[model samples]
Structures are given as C-alpha cells and as structure tokens.
Target: MSGYLALLGSSFEFFCLVILDLERFALAGQPHWDELEATLQRLENDPDRGFHDLAAAQRFHYLYQRAASDLGRLASFSAETSLRRRLEGLVARAYAELHSAREARDTRWRPLVWLLETFPRTFRRHAGAWWLAVAVTLLGSVVGAFLVAADPEAKASLLPFGHGEMNPSERVAKEEAGRSKGLANRRSSFAAELMANNIRVSLKAVAFGLTWGIGTLAILFYNGVILGGVMLDYLRAGEGLFLAGWILPHGSTEIPAIVLGGQAGLMLARGVIGWGARVPLGRRLRAIAPDVATIIGGLALLLVWAGIVESFLSQYHEPVLPYWLKITFGVANLAILGAWLFLCGRGPTPED
Candidate 1:
C-alpha cells in the first residue's frame, strides 16, 4: 500500500513538471548557452528558493561559461552560412554541459544520484494523494464526456486544444480527404508518414504536460478529462474495443510517460508556488529535477513505441488474437507500470 502511494505521488509530480516547462521551452526554444547560465545564477539568488549545494551550483555556473564562449564563436558566422555549421557548435556545448553535469553527480553530488535511484522506490509513498489525483482526473473526464455526449454541437469543440496557429486535426483531415496523388500513396502505400504523425501527436501530448503540470491542478484536471472524453467517444461508437487494441501496445508506454511529464511540470509549480510549505526550495527542486528528466526521457522512448504501434500494430484491420490475449497483455502492461513504480529503488529521505 505504501509503495502504491509513492508511485501515485511520483506520477503526480512528473505530470506537474511537464505541464510547467512545455510552454517555456516552446517559446524560447530551450535555454541557449547564456540563458541557462543566467537561470542558474538567478536560481542561486532566489530568496525563497536557492541552491543548497555549492558544488552543484558552481558546476552549472562553469557549464554556462563554456556555453557562453561557444555561442560567441557561433555568432561570428556570416548570414550566408548554412544552419548545419551553427547548430553543430551549439549542440556540442549542450551535450558537453549535460555530460559534465552527469559526471559531477558521481563526484560532487552522489546524494543527487542516490535520490534519483531511490525515487521509483517511493511508488507507494503518497498512496492516498496519488489515488486522489487519479480519481479527480477520472471523475473530471467522466463529467466532460457526459457534457459532450449531452450536446452534439459541443462535440466538435471537444476535439483538442490547438497549439500553434492552426488546428492539426483539421489539417490532417483535409489532407486525408483530398484527391491528390500524394495523398493516394499516403493512404494506401508507405508507413513512414503514419509513423511521423504518431510521433508528432505523442510529442505534442508530452509537451502539453508542461502547461498542464505548472499552471495549476485545474490544468491537469482539464487535460485528464479531455483525454477521457476522447477515449469515451470512441468507446461509445462501438470502436472502443478496437481503439483500445490499437492504443494499448504503444499507449502502455505513451500515456504514463505523458502523465510523468506532467509530474515534471508540478515540480516546477511546487518550486514557484512554494506551497507555503516549510521545506527549503533548493532541496525540493533538486529532488524534482531528475525525476522530471526521467519522465521526459521516458516520453521520448514511448514516442518510438507509439510509432511502431501506429505504423504496424494499429494497421491491423482485424483482431489477430483472442480477447483473453488482449486482456492479458493489457493487464500485463498495467502491472509492469505498477512494478516500475514500486520495486525500482527506495527513496533517499522519507519526506519530500
């Protein structure tokens, strides 16, 4: 029971983290050499929340300095130069900073590593709250679906939250409905395009976690409800079982990762809100960062699985196995998620 609580808490935490960071990352396109360094300095100077570890703080500072210097060289490139030359240098600096940070974990901040290793162990730590979060999300979804089902006009409105300048669903629908030869091949031929679309959708969902996690519990609640409604709609249309068959294989990997990404956003939110809680900000954030990264990294892997599912598994027009087999696989998937949460490692400190 304790382990289950911990997993629930961790899931909530990851969900919050992704929601908070996504918008920021998109608008700014990730921290450049100078920006990341500035963020570190800013974090140190924060009155409510500052770095408790000097070595970790200094290491980030050093990385920023190197990044800054590299950016300086890149800035000198002429406008006529292609992007490959400019991006290569920037990419190298980012990787270097990331690697150095990882190396410092072993030498300067072993506790940070221990904390990360121990995180999955706490799967049962906040069992009550974890269950509550899921319940709240589930209830919200049920209500949202009820509202949509109650009104045919509102159904279209519930399609999705459009990012960027246009609606992706609308664009895709148009492309698929067109009569062009290009569309013909996409419909009847290769799987690459389908894989690409799946990847895009999964990434968008993961990215949205940043907003859902950081904005507020309301944001997370809304996303949960939206997802529920979408799935519920298919189920009502007698496609529920078929949709489940298509989604389960990849969704096993995809959905949890998105939820985890949301946890990351929550981490950022906790940092910002301070929750009026007694804990120091630095420690709280440090605990949150790695977990956030873990989920984000997990999301990337899930996208790959999603591609496979979309390209091949979902393409299966007929059910290939018995109903029991599908149920077994589905249960197995949930069990694996459960095990990952509880059995991985013990938490470093009992309290967050």
Candidate 2:
C-alpha cells in the first residue's frame, strides 16, 4: 500500500493514489515518472547543470524515493514485467544520479569556500596547538634577547645573512643610501628563492612531527631566538624604525606561516602521543592527518606572499620607502591576517 501519501491529507496531486487499482495507479504515476525521467535526462545531458535551489534538489530526492517505491510495488504484478523493468531502470538511474561519487565531490569541494571559510575554521579548531607554538617561540626569543643583552659579541653567531659583524645602524644607513641594490637585477629570482626556502622550512616544521615533536619545537625555538637576537641588536642600535619597517612587511605573514607549520607538527605529535585519547594509534593519526594537511596548505600560500613582499618591498629602505609608511603597511597586514584567522568563518555556515 503506497499509503504514505495519506499524510498529504487530500492534496489534489496525491488524491488518486489513495484508492486506485493497478491500471489507475499506473495512469496516475505515469506523469510523475515522466517528470523524474526528464529531470534525469537533463542532468545527464548537461552535467554541469546542478540543481540551483534547495527546493528543486529536495524534489529530485523525493522523486527518487517515489520511483523506488513504485518499482517495489511493481514487483508483485507478474504480468507487469515490462512496466517493472522500465521503472527499475529509472529508479537505478535516479539513485546513481543522486549518489554518484563525482557529484558528491562537486557538492562538497568549493575552493573559495574552503580558502575563506574552511581553512580558518580548521585553524581555529586547532588553535590551541598554534598558541602553544607561539609560546614556545616566545620563550626562545626571551632566551636569545637575554644572551644578546649580556654579550654584544654573540650577534655574529646569533645572526645570519652577514648581519652579525655589521652594526644595525650602519646597515640601515647603507640601505637608505641605496646600497640595498643587492637584488636589483635579480628581484624575481630572489623572491623565488625566498619562497622556496621559507616553504621548505615550514614543511620541515610540519615533517618534524615524526620525531614526536622534539624537532618541531627545536625549529620553532631556534626561529624565535633568531628574531629576538635581531630585534635586540637593532633596538640597541636605536634602529627601531628600521627594524619594524624591514621585518613587519614579510614577518607579518611569514612568521605566522612558520608558526602554523609548527601547529600542524604539534597536532601530529599529539596524535602520535594520543595521551588522553582512547582510539588506536593508527586511527588517531589518520583522523588528524587532514587537518595537518589543510593547515600546511594554507601556510604555504601565506609564505609565498610573504616571500614576494620580503624581496620586492621589505628590502627597500628608508629614503626609498619611508619607515613610517612601511611600518603602517606591516601593522595593517598583521591586523588583517589576525582578523581573517579569528573571525572570517564564524558565521551560520557549518564549520565542518
């Protein structure tokens, strides 16, 4: 008995189904069958023409269920072989259309949505790990700052790119005097090098989770030490403006990207440790793998942008680009990145 329509309570469309014989039932269902078939044909012919509205998609699912019910009923009528076969085929096609793996992918994967929404949501979901990374880096910075303040000569070993032996004030003077032309003819190549190097470093931060996070923590701490040493050195030289201008443009994004990698690494280590979790180690690792991958992917994009800025903009000094203006740009960039991470995806849309 296809009496489910009784819920409609005398609706004109379903009224005939309440007490119809086989022939009458066939007559009534024929129109709906034709409609479902036509919709399916349209979908097959124009694969990209997905349902445009919730109502239409709902109708399609309802039609599928109805066709399936009709096929089941036809199974009892031995003389209705032709009708049964036709309906079975239609029901099968409708089922495939609704559940096809390709359609499932199309429905779930939206790149822009993932970028602006899903990535932020995922990062927020695992923000504890990221904050932990920040804290570790901060601790390392403290240690590095202490060492630099105590021993001025430590800068040689504490700094890189030949910043050790030279005074920060002298470097700033030279750069402002237009001696920063080191990459003038090779800006593109330098930018590419920065991108590749930074991405590799970030990936290493993530990959180090295989060591149960020890290596990841070390990498993060070392980075913090470098930053702290540089900051203390420049500020000591009364080059605070130069430091802010030089670091902020790229560091605004680059530092966070690296920290994000550390976050992913910590997350992986958490899975490996599974301290409070009751699941099997393998299952735990598998569960967190996607989150790790997503964070890494987002950070890679951030690093690319940071690398470009570092080479093309961050390298230019005071007279060419005012320190105040550069510092303002960096502050703005930092604020934007912070807002995007903290607020972008916290709307009505489902987070997962």
Candidate 3:
C-alpha cells in the first residue's frame, strides 16, 4: 500500500514537471518564432533581394528545425494546441523556402517598351472594334444634329448638364472677358475632377461589354449625341471658332479615349461570343486578355493628358491665350496623336 501511494505521488510530480516545462519552453521560443517570422517577411517582400546571405539562410534553417522539434514535443500536450498549430504553420512555410529547387525566371518591368510598342500594336490589332464604335457614334451624332436643327426645342432634351440653358455665344463672350479666371486657383482640382469623371466613363464603357456590347453601344451613342448637339448649338450661335478652340484642345484626346474604351468593350464581347472560333470559352478569353489590358492602359494615358489640357490650356480663352494659337495647338496635337497610334508601331522595330 505504501509503495502504491509513493508511486501516485511521483506521478503527480511528473505531471507538474511537464506543465512547468511547457510554460518555460513556450516563453523561451517566442522570441525565436518572432525572429523567424520577421526573416520570412523580409524574404517574401523582396524577391529581388533573394537568398544571398548565407548566415540568414543557416539561421532560418535552424529556426525551422527548432520549431519542428517544439511542435513534436507539444504533441503529447493538449493545453498548447494553438501553439502547436502556429509552429506547424511556421515549419511548413520554412520547409517550402528551404526545399524550393526551381529557379524562378527574373522578369523586370519595362514601361517604355510597353507604351511605345505594345499599346499601339494592340490598338491596331483591334482597329475594327474602334471603327465600329466610331460608326455608331457618328450615326448618333448625325441623328442628334438633325433633331436639334429641325426643332430648337430638342436641345433641352438632348443636351445635358445645363449646356442647353446657356447661349453658346454669350458663354464664349463671358469666357473671353475673364470668366475663365474661375478656374485659375482651381485648375488642379478641376483637372483631377475631369480625369476622375472621364476615367469613370471610360471604365463603364469597358465594363458594359458584358451585355454583349449593347450597353457599350448605348454609352457611345449617347456621348456622341451629346457632343453633336453641343457642337451644333455653338455653330448656330456663330461661336464656331470659339467652339473649335475650346473643345478640340481636349476633345482630340478625350474623344478617342472614350472610343478606345468602346473598342475594349467590343473585344470583350467578341471573346464572349466566340463567333467563328472553335476554341473553348476560356481559351478565347485568354487570347484577348492581354489585348484588353493593353487597351485600358492606353485609354487611361489619353484621358489623363486630356484632363490636363482641358484644365490648363482649353479654359484660357482668346485674351489670355489667342484663339488662333489654341487652334493650331489642337491641330498639331491631333496630328501627332494620330501618327503615334497609326504609324509608330507599323514597321519592324530596330531590335528586329
């Protein structure tokens, strides 16, 4: 009986010792775990840095082994289940890093090549979609102009954003007489707002392709109608030169940007339709995926430039900046943009 009682006491003592040991080990290893986490984070954050430091590699390996050992020791105890799980995760991550045998290909970003070559080439490849967008817009414009010209009352319904309320000639006179100063202190804010509004419109044009391009067509047509109505209004008011100087400076870029967005939408629609293509839906989409991204990139660049031009140059009417000068700038800008899109990427590159 005494031997049995002594054995029970010794078992209780062993239990107490295990609990104490668990507490001590957990406390001691926390710092190592933290160090390992920090090291892993550094490696993950900078792929370019790579595993160049031998000391770090050795320390990482050692920490992983220690965590694994701790995990094994904790297996018999249920009280430290959470710690065991954490250690397991850390050990697994470390193992992956240590055992990775494949050398990853280094890919660096080259913005210039993408901008100068890729963007325009993708645009040219999808020119059919752009032309279709242009045709739909032109049709709408013609319809809008005819409606407004036949019935002056139609301007109120067709023209939006209070444009129909203002007489174009009066507005031009006010702008030339220094109402243009309204944007002086607020040019940057105005520019930012313009960019946001135009970019949002462009993105919607791209997103609407999900409707098999009906939505995209509607957006393009509506924009064109609005543009045509406004142009006709200014011309009727005998403010044609002012209209040209005002709209052309930014419209040269902004209009094309919207059209390109429609182009992207049409491309997405084509991928969805897979009309003549026998490939699977996934493959068709995959083929045009890069092209869609390329078009979006171009649209963004064009809109940003347009926003700057509208805010900085377009608003400065005749007195602040000559009408003739603005007209010339607009013409030159359009010509240069046309050449960049159509001619720049046509032939073989010097590298070829």
- Top lDDT prediction, candidate number: 2
For model 2, name the residue pairs that clash.
none
What lDDT tens digits, residue by residue, belong to model 3 across residues 178-214? Answer: 8644686899999999999999999899999878898
- lDDT by residue for model 2 (310-333), tens: 998998886889888889889999
Error of 3 at 48 (Å): 9.3
Off by over 4 Å in 3: 1-107, 179-181, 349-352
Candidate 2 Cα lDDT to native: 0.87
TM-score of structure candidate 1:
0.49
Ranking by lDDT: 2, 3, 1
Angstrom error of the Cα, residue 136, model 1: value is: 4.8
Provide the RMSD of all predictions against the true structure, rounded to 1 decimal: 19.8, 8.6, 9.7
Point out where model 1 deviates above 4 Å. Answer: 1-119, 122-136, 161-219, 276-287, 319-327, 346-352
lDDT of each: 0.52, 0.87, 0.85
lDDT of 1 by residue, 87-131 (tens): 455556445545555434333334454434544543244343245
